[model samples]
Target: MTKSVDSTAPVLTSVRQRTGVIELNRPKALNSLNPEMIDIIAKAVKNWEDDDSIDQIVLYTTNPKAFCAGGDVRFARDNILSGDAQLVDDFFAAEYTLNGKLATYKKPLVSIIDGVVMGGGLGISLHGSHRVVTENAFASMPEMAIGYFTDVGVAHAAQRMVGTRGQASPALAKYWAITGYRMYAADMLWSGLATHAVQDAETILDAIVENGADTALKQHSYVPDGEAPLA
Candidate 1:
């Protein structure tokens, strides 16, 4: 049954068979995470987590340029400057809590990233059990560019990821934290940040629902054609 489970105002969401799909829909803001979006996603995930009929959760976006650029920092800045400290506090609290929930989701969580993803977008995708990226996928953690540090538990993945160099080093994670170096799908897959890279990621969501992830991804997964500079 196709049912809208989350906010259609911006964050479009629906249930397709046993899969609960969350689509980042705020293209005007590059799908930046706002309190409302956070609330909707968190609530929907919680609902699906307890729903026995739901077999998995899927996150994707339709924007051609970006999956999610990051959190709505402009909103945070404006609210903080307006002395609405409570609102600012609530936003981060909800967002961070939602991050934790996504990281620990009970069911198979799949993130299909086909475009630019950074900051909060990384939060949404990197924590998932299966991160499928397309050739167009690009990513970074730009918090450092703004005089802030990375959050949403990205440091956990960064420090732990074993690149093709066959070594896991904290220095590598620190380099990304400080430089915000741009990375493509090849770099992501080679670094173990993204689990699978495919020329066509279009089949992932539906295929996983019908054929299961192992069989579905096996059919489409391939080496990214781009150069892995980080490798």
Candidate 2:
């Protein structure tokens, strides 16, 4: 008897229980992060954090091609092209705040990284307590390629992954830092950026539920998992 919350504007859905799952539903935009989606997710996460019924959360996006390609570049591009300089500033402020909240979330958080997980997407996933990657997973911090500095708390997390100052060195962060290079799941795991490499997501998800691991949840009993194509 899982309770679900669906949002129209932001394209997000939340299935509530002891262990909750949030899905990014806007596949058209490659599940790109936008102001509305950011606000909704931030509010939902805050609400769930205080709800005793929720013990864990799994964050995922609908775009099989991309877990999240990044922020809504078109939005920014529109503003810039229209000479609306303030739009970029506002977007970043809200987005970064959301990222910070995620970084400090109270309960166990899990992210299933299957495809393109770049820029803001990386921030959302990497901060989780358990970050799972599939063979199809690809990740990068490519802000520099677009004439932007890496935000969404990447500076700290990247440094942690690659070591202090080492994250800035060419031998380490250069792929993403300079060229916005995307790394495959195997490489990501080898680089110490991802935790588990799951080959069968469906089986794993079923196990999590059948094992009664989410006793805290009130409604939903199970979540489906499967291979998602790259967006």
Candidate 3:
């Protein structure tokens, strides 16, 4: 039986076997990362690490339309118009901190991307050890359009992507930061922006539980051919 988590919560967290499951829960808002949601997710991750019963974290979203569209920039814009600078500062600080932590997290971090993943969404999942995308997944970094640069470890993560010759180039990173191009599953996987692509997300949790993340990834992950999207 599938039971729903708290509808009022911004993020619903539960422990399933040895996996700590975190579901971004604001479907109406498309799971947009607000200050409250950031704090909740950070605290949950830290607590789960301390809990010996939990061995890994699986981050997903309740919203079918979006994993997380982006940060609550509209809220920040409102605050900025009202001259409440503290809110904007606090939000970015908390978010960037969380992103940094996830990048270096000791245990396995599995982020399931099955819908729209952009901006802050990219920040969270791209930093994870395993980013799992389904056929429905789509991602982008359109911060440039808003006169903002890519933040949240994109600088580091983008460097890991390589060309067809297995050589890294800063040109790929520069192109993405400037163009803010949207990428689909095939492009994401081919460019190394996403680690794995499955036909569906149905088996992800079970595979991780039964075989551990690395082994499970091998079973479910796929790579698409053709030129690298950025390179």
Candidate 4:
């Protein structure tokens, strides 16, 4: 049984057996990665890494509409325009560091990405051991649209995708980075961006509970058949 933590918390963290669960809690903001959220998550991840009770992590969002829309770009823009550019710098430092930590995490890291996983969202989930996408998921690196270069380790991730899926040329990867084109679940799978695509969130979690993370993912993954339906 899952234990409920403080519901009011901006980012809720809990543990079940060897699995540590992190749920992004700011649905109204589309669970945007802000400075505070970044700090809290980074701290929690470090603590969990050291905790004997936790052996793995599952990062997900509470909102069904969005795992994370992006970074707190509005906040970043406002602060920069107000001449408080330090805030932007701090945000980047914290976010990129957290992204690195997630990428290199010693234990298994599972990201349950359902919807609107874009920009900084991809940074958080894409680097982990498992990236589980749902039918509703929509992904992109939309930083260019906001006049910002793709960041938060996106450059490296995009490069890896290009190498893994040789069908897509290097120039195509660059175009996606610079153009902010949205990608559906099939496209993401085809491009080697996500690990698995499932029909729903509950099904994946139930599989995880029964079969453990990696086995469950392999069993449910739609990639083997090479058929990721658009509908």
Candidate 5:
């Protein structure tokens, strides 16, 4: 059975048996992370963490263009432009805390990286135990483009991806660390950022349910054996 909750009037939470699905419903905002939404997500995760019933969690978005674009830049711009340093500090602190929680989460967590999985979106998805990317998926760090360094543990995650002080030319690392160039699904998988590349989002979701919550995830669970008609 699937259950849902509408918190902060915009974000929607859905749970099916031991699987919880959190949907970023603000398609107009490109499902950008905002203060309220962040709080809601953190609280929901905490609740599920203690609930023995939930063994898996899936974070996704309603917008096909973006799983999540990133933090609400307009919000940041307004606060910074208005000379509100406290707002900036608070936002970063809260967002980073939420990211950390997800990183070390106990239960199996699956992130569906279907669209614009950039900056903030990367934080939400990259740390999950199972990260699924679809053909529509694109990922990047691109914080330098906006005159900011990567945050939300990008430094650590990047090093993990590139290895510690390897001579293999840090160009790939630099692209994500500095330029924030969005990577396609294939590149994301090759770079070891996304675990699996699925052909269709719905099929992957169905597979998760059918596989049972306690089943160990297969690395290539997303890849279909052969091509099929488009849904």
Candidate 6:
């Protein structure tokens, strides 16, 4: 059975063939997550988390230019200027909670990332079980650029990467956190930030649904579709 979540929300959600799909929708704003968007996503994630009918979760962005530019810093900034400390705090509280939920989710979570994925974007995608990227994917934490520390569970991932870098430098994640270096597809894959590099996202989603994640990934990983990923 297919059920559509509220179409009017900033984040769009639906269940299709036992998969819960989330599409980030604020295209004009580059799909940056705001408090309301966070709430909507959290609700859908929670609602589907324990549902036996939903076997997997898929997250992507409708914006072609950006997967997610991260959390809406402009929203926080305006609230800060207005002296709404509580609003700002509430936003982070909810965002982090959603991040944690995905991190610990029992079911498989797959994120097909293309275009700009930064800060909170990485938070949502990287923690998932399958982090799929295309040739167009460009990722960064970039919090240091604005005088803020990079967060949203990135530190947890960085800590795990310390001693286990197979093709990447042991210090790669740490260096990125400090320098906010922008990484393209090859670097993202080698650094272990992205688990798979594919020709397209949509086909991979369909394949996963039909063939299961491990088999579909094995059949499609690192294949060329006119333009192969750098890695």
Number of backbone collisions per candidate, in order?
Answer: 0, 12, 0, 0, 1, 0
Give lDDT tens digits, candidate 1, residues 1-231. Answer: 675654557787788878888888898998999998898789889989989988888898868678889889999999989999899889889888888888888988888888889999988888888889888889999998788888888888899887555767788789889899888888887777788887755677678778767778898888856568885
Residues 1-231, model 3: lDDT tens digits: 122366579898877778888889988888889998999899988887777787889898877689889999898899999999998999999999999989888888999888899899989899888888888889888899999998887867787765234656566677788988888887787667777887766587678867778888888777666665444
Q: What is the lDDT of residue 153 in candidate 6?
A: 89
- lDDT-based ranking: 1, 3, 6, 4, 5, 2
For model 4, where is the 10-residue window of minimal lDDT?
A: 222-231
Model 4 stretches astray by more than 4 angstroms: 1-5, 162-169, 224-231
Q: In candidate 4, how many Å is residue 3 off?
A: 6.1
Q: Kindly list the per-residue Cα lDDT of model 4 for residues 1-231, writing each as its tens digit.
A: 354467887788777667888888999999998887888789878988988877678888888999988899889989999999987998988898899999899888888998898888988898888888888998988878767787878777766663224554555568777888887777777776777888888778767766789888878876535554421
- Alpha carbon lDDT of each predicted model: 0.84, 0.68, 0.82, 0.81, 0.75, 0.82
Residue 25's lDDT within candidate 4 is 92
TM-score for all models, in order of appearance: 0.93, 0.81, 0.91, 0.90, 0.86, 0.90
Task: Please report, as a residue range, the 10-residue window in candidate 3 with the lowest summed lDDT.
Answer: 161-170
Q: How accurate is candidate 1 locally (lDDT)?
A: 0.84
Clashing pairs in 5: 142-180
In model 5, the worst 10-residue window by lDDT is 162-171
Residue pairs with backbone overlap in model 6: none
Sliding window of 10 residues with minimal summed lDDT for model 6: 161-170
Please write out the lDDT profile of model 2 over residues 13-124, one tens digit for every residue. Answer: 4554466767777777778898887877787788889888777777866556777888999999999899997988899899988888888999878777767888888878
Window of ten residues with lowest summed lDDT in model 1: 1-10
Q: Over the stretch 13-38, how does candidate 5's per-residue lDDT look in tens digits? A: 87876688888888888888989889
- By TM-score, the best candidate is 1
lDDT of 2: 0.68
